[model samples]
Target: MSKEAQFSTDKFRLDGKVAIITGGASGLGFNYTKAMLISGAKVVIASYDEKGWDETSKFAKSVNGEVKFIKIDVTAKEAPDIIVNAALSKFQKIDILVNNAGMQRRNNSVPI
Candidate 1:
C-alpha cells in the first residue's frame, strides 16, 4: 500500500469570488458575513431588518471589502431571483451561496 499527500495553496484564496448570504444582518449570519469578508470574498446580505442592514453595511465598508445589503423577505416567491440578480449585477458572477434566513414561532397547545 502507498500513501500520498497533496496540497494546493490556491484552495484557501477567495479573491474575485462573490457570496450571497441571507439573514446576514445579525447573529450567526453576521459572523459568517464577517468571516467571508476577511477571506477576501465579496458579500451581499439580504435581510428584513432595516437598522441592522444599515449598521452591517457601515461595518462592512470599514473593513474595506465590497458589501451590500438588500431588504427582502426570503419567504417571498420572487426573493430568490431578486437576490441572484442583485449579486450578479454587482459582481457579475456568484461563486457561493449562504441561505441562512429562517424563523421559528412558539407553539400553543391545541384545543381538543
Candidate 2:
C-alpha cells in the first residue's frame, strides 16, 4: 500500500514567497513574521519602532530565517512607497503583504 502524505503546516508553506509585514517588530505582528519565516517565506518587517528591529533580527537568526527590516511610520503618506521599494530592493518580488501596522493611545484607565 502506498503511504499517505501527512497534513501539517507544510500545507500552508510559503516557499519562494516574499512578505511585507507592517508592525512586525513587536506584538502580534512579530508573531506573524516568525510564522512566515518558518514557513519558508522571506520577510521584510516594517515598523515604527527601530529598536524592535534588533530583537526581531535576533529571533530570525536563531531560526535561520531570511529577514529584513525598515523603520517608517505606516501613517505617513510616503509609507506605502517606502515599504514597497524596500521589499522590492531586497527580494525583487512581493507575494504577501500583512497590513498589521497601527497605533492607539489611551486617554484614561478603566475605573476599578
Candidate 3:
C-alpha cells in the first residue's frame, strides 16, 4: 500500500468552523443548530422569533457551544445582509450555511 492514509475519522468534525443557520431557533432548524454546535462549529442562528433566541441560547450554554442569535425575517429584503454581518461580527468567518428558514400556515377551506 502507498503511504497515503485512506480515511481519517474526523468526517463530521467541525473544529474551528463557523456556521450560519437561518431559522435555526426552532423546529428542524434548531436540530441542525444543535448538531453543528456539538460538532465543534461556532454557530450564528438567524431566526425571526426573538423568544427562540433565549431558548436556543440556554441550550448552547448547556452544551458549552458558542452561539449567537440575530432576529431577522428571512423573507425580508434586507435579511441577507443582516445575517451575514451578524455572523462575520461574531465568528469572523462563515464556513457552513444551513439555509433552512421556512414558514407554514394552516387555513381552513370552505366547500364551494
Candidate 4:
C-alpha cells in the first residue's frame, strides 16, 4: 500500500477524534493546531486576543479542516466549561485537550 494508505489505518488515523487547543491563535499553539488538523483531528482554538483569533481562523479555513475560535479568558472560572461546551457543540465529542493557555511576566527583582 502507499504511504497515505498506511497512515490511514485505525491506529494512525484520528478521523473521529476531537482536539481542544488553548492559546492556539499563534506561536507554539498555532503549530499544534496545524499538526492536529493534518492528523485528521477536529480542533477548537480558544483565545482572548481578537486580531490573533481572526488570523488563526483565516489560516485554519485555508487548511480545509474543521476549526473554530472561541473568545475566552483562561483565568476565568467559567472559561473551561465554556470551551468544553463549545467543542462538544461543534464536534460532539472531545478525544484530546491541549491546555496551552497562560501568560508570564518578568520580574527583575524579588522583594522580601
Candidate 5:
C-alpha cells in the first residue's frame, strides 16, 4: 500500500489544525464547534455575546478538546483584524475560519 493510504486515518485527523469560528458561542456556530473539536481540531469561538460561552465551555469539557472564546462582531470594520490577531495569539496559525456570525429578525409591523 502507498504511504497516503497507510496514513488515511491520520490524514482525516486534525491533530495540528486550528479553526476560528465566528458567532460560535451559540446556534449553528455552537454545533460547528462541537463537530470540529470531535474531529481533533483546536477551535477558537468568536462571539459578541458571552452568555453562550458557558454552553460552549461545557461542550468542550465533555469532548475533551481545546476550545477558546474570543469576543468579536463581524459587522465592525476592524473585526477581521481583531479576529485574525485573536486566532494567532491563541493558536499561532489559523487553518480554518467559519464566517457564521449573522442575525435574522422579523418586522412585526409589516404584514406577510
Candidate 6:
C-alpha cells in the first residue's frame, strides 16, 4: 500500500500530546482547540479575552481532556516565551503550537 493509504486510527490519535493555541478563546483558534481536545491532546489556550476563557475552558473540560487558559497579549515580544513556559510548566513539553492570534488596525490610525 502507498504511504497515504497506510493511515490508521492510532495514527490519527493525539494521546499524550500537548498543544498551545493562541487566540483560542474564540474564532478559528477555538475550533482548533476543540479538535485537539477531542483527539486526546492536552491543550493550553492563550488569549486576551477573559470572558471567553471560562466558557471555552468549560467545554474543553467536559471533553475529559486537560485544558488551561492563560490570559496573554500575543503582540508582546515576551508572549511566545511566556506561553512556552506555561505549557512546559503544566505538561512538561509542547508538541503543537497554533499561532492563531492576530490584530488589524482600523481607519489606518487605530491602535492594535
Best by lDDT: 2
Cα lDDT listed for each candidate: 0.81, 0.85, 0.83, 0.79, 0.82, 0.83
Task: Indicate the worst ten consecutive residues by lDDT in candidate 3.
Answer: 1-10
> Residue by residue across 1-112, what tens digits does model 1's lDDT show?
3362232325566777899999887888887787777677899998887657766777678767889788889878999999999889988999999998878859975579
Instruction: Estimate the TM-score for candidate 2.
Output: 0.81
Write the residue-wise lDDT of candidate 4 on 10-110 in tens digits. Answer: 45656778999898878788777777776778888888875576666676677567888898897789998999999989988899989887787696554
Q: Is candidate 1 or candidate 6 better by lDDT?
A: 6
Over 4 Å off, model 3: 1-10, 105-112
Winner by TM-score between candidate 6 and candidate 4: 6
lDDT of 3 at 28: 86
Q: Residue 30 CA error for candidate 1 (Å)?
A: 0.4
Name the lDDT value of residue 32 in candidate 6. Answer: 81
How many residue-pair clashes does candidate 6 contain? 0
Residue 43's lDDT in candidate 3 = 93
Candidate 1 has what TM-score?
Answer: 0.78
Off by over 4 Å in 2: 1-8, 105-112
Q: 2 or 4, which is superior by TM-score?
A: 2
Where in model 5 is the C-alpha error above 4 Å? 1-12, 105-112
**Total backbone collisions, model 3:** 0
Clashing pairs in 2: none
Clashing pairs in 5: none
lDDT of 2 by residue, 1-112 (tens): 3472233556798889999999987888988887887788899988878867887888788867889888788888999999999899999999999999876667775489
What is the Å distance of residue 48 in model 6 from its true position?
Answer: 1.1
Candidate 6 lDDT over residue span 14-90, tens digit each = 99999999888787887787788878999998888776777677877797878988898988899889989999999
